[model samples]
Target: MVLAAASHALSYFQAVVIGLLQGVTELFPISSLGHSVVIPKLLGWDSLAKAQSQSESFYLAFLVALHVGTAIALLVYFRKEWYGIIGGFFTSIAKRRIETPDERLAWLLVVATIPAGITGLLLEHELRTVFAKPLAAAVFLMVNGLMLLAGDRYRRRAEVRELVRTHASTESETEVGRRLDTLDFKESVAVGVAQIGALFAGISRSGITMIAGLARGLDHEDAARFSFLLATPIIFGAGLIKLPDLFGHLGNGVRGQSLVGAIAAAVAAYVAVRFLMSFFETRTLWPFGIYCLAFGGLCTLLFI
Candidate 1:
């Protein structure tokens, strides 16, 4: 059965609310999908959450448009990186060798995207069918929180151990620098594989990837950058795949609402990424983890 569109139709208010929520939560380590599902239920807009009709098609399209907005924001914000990747891609083809850091990083991103692409191709529909229940989403959100917390603890301990070793030696702190561009094939592949977890409704794409990066000893800032960069292809691809489905519903006012929602989503996502990049320079993911845990637990208690 198809899901009911938000409030039986894609109202402007619903569009903006869901758009803002998607933009903010999409990158905040909490599950945007979980919020998309739970928020409607909590607001007593159960009709909005039901998979019932062609209107549901519009809603899904609207969500995809929000993702497209988010992807666009990432692209705009990271245009420099994209430029390098593009140039390096061509250069590698022409030269028959990857020589520059950009070229190598481009290849790394390709390696990083492969696993997720494969995973989505193989399991997206299955997972969506099996785990679309709000209770399951809530439960997985808690799991996501626990994963974040555990990852943080593990990284902190690793950092402490590294600090001790550094202090014991003659090297200065400034001398211990990370080169994110120098990630080997193995590390890149690992990060890519870790991205598979995000297919779960409550699992976060950026959060899981950053955790994987931390495991590979990247600092938070660099890890966040890497995660955001890697997110572009997947997010954009998902949106594109859903765009055709939206066309049939465009005449029903879905088009205008989608435009507004996409704009709101883009602006919000740009602001969020800007803040998060600076924030992660010094802050840990603990706060977001705690929030997810509390929110998820509350959702579980109330809904399950």
Candidate 2:
């Protein structure tokens, strides 16, 4: 039987708004999951929120669809990188060695993804029962702001120290930016471990991973690149895992809205990635940090 009917249909406008919100926030170091949970409550969509609270599978499957849309956007935008990684994956198997930088980077992403996969498999259901609530997610969103600020400040200090050391050394001394391919296995593992934190509703996958990258000495732009690249497989894989359940919840009435939402999510994600690739080159995460603090605080006040 159909598990349970939603009390009301999700309107097209609401679908679009939620899709845009999810897509943009997914890449922007804000928590997409947090927004999805909180926005419905804030908008007074009582039936939807009640349904979500009642049927975790329904809401989770909807989120999975949104994530799949974002993943598709990432795949299209980063097609070149994906090509290299795929080639490297096969070449390493043939050669019996991870020879190329691309191959090593590919392996590194695999290593980094392990913790999240394991953590999710073990803890996802349990955590969702507690942390997926609007009030709890809102509280964690503010905590996310603090994490961003701390990461940015740490990176700045590290950079300054590096600059001073460079100045003290010979004029011909070389400096290396921590490019994705250059990350040591241990460092990659550290980043992967950090990704476990993102399983919580308000902790952003990109935000935490990039924080770990910055902590490991990557420049802002490169950190963002690695973060986005690392995100593709996880998001896509999660969506794929949840897809069957998502379809189960769909009917003639709800399926169209879901498709519309997915398309809107794809468009928004593409724009977000394009804008952020440029923005991080010259900008810092401080603005995002501030925004999270303000927005999270407002949500907390309203919800609590």
Candidate 3:
């Protein structure tokens, strides 16, 4: 399906380009696939011209390549976690043991992935339409920027409330801060539900979901860890569902483009995964979100 098409279509240079996009955008608050759609749409003179009369389908296969590449990146980055999860699931089943934190976290990821899974099932076609037009994706990228800003704002507000609670209990003027893990499952579910919106809007899956985690009081690192882990199952599931049709409409240059794009995506996505986790430890998401805004706004001004 999509994986096969993506595998078949890849070329050397295109792989690097699309892989870079997939890797970078996937980690940053800006959507990688969103950029994959928008960049070509707005900057592609010939393609844009063709769309004046009707949309072309040139990028669909590219999109599939990026997704497959991303899926591979995710699997590789999180392999250790997956091993623990798989082992824990089987151990729990055979021995009726749920002692390990990994088992519980594994269950949590399952719960978290459900909202997006259901949402995608219901709205996938409509969501695909959004990517068919580059300008629209650019506009949505702007909206994603707002989402990040709003997420940071809300998270800070929640922190304030937590501080008040902390102060009421503590007698000392200065104390170490509580980590994000102190938050409850309710917060995780809230974040999971928020992820559903990403179905229609060009919202970053990581951005919205991470915001949801932050809203529930998870620290940036923990929130991000959970975000990447939660994302895999859903994205992988979507790829599986689309596997069939990837062959039917095979684009003109799919084979070569896919090869280049996939390699790029793999290398880039690998770097992005490594880079972003480190970045989340110290930096705020404001910068990434604002970047999305600038790009989105630029696309709008230039095109419309």
Winning model by TM-score: 2
Q: How displaced is residue 87 in candidate 3, in Å? A: 1.8
Q: lDDT of candidate 3 vs native?
A: 0.67
Q: How high is the CA lDDT of each candidate model?
A: 0.80, 0.80, 0.67
Model 1: runs farther than 4 Å from truth?
A: 1-7, 52-56, 158-177, 249-252
For candidate 2, which ten residues in a row score worst on lDDT? 167-176
- Ordered from best to worst TM-score, the candidate numbers read 2, 1, 3
Inter-residue clash pairs, candidate 1 = 2-51, 2-52, 2-53, 3-50, 3-51, 3-52, 4-50, 4-52
TM-scores of all predicted structures: 0.89, 0.90, 0.81
- Tens digits of per-residue lDDT, candidate 2, 1-304, equal 3433531447778778888988999999988877777888889876555444443545556667788999999999999998999899889989999989889978988899898888887887777777877888888899999999999898767564474344322121223344557677898899999988888888888999999987777767878888999999989988888788677744324566677888999999999999999888777789888888888899999987
Predicted structure 2: lDDT? 0.80
Q: Write the per-residue lDDT of candidate 3 for residues 89-194, one digit (tens) a residue.
A: 6777787866676766766776677777887888776766645356677788899999899887776785645843563221223222234434445666777888
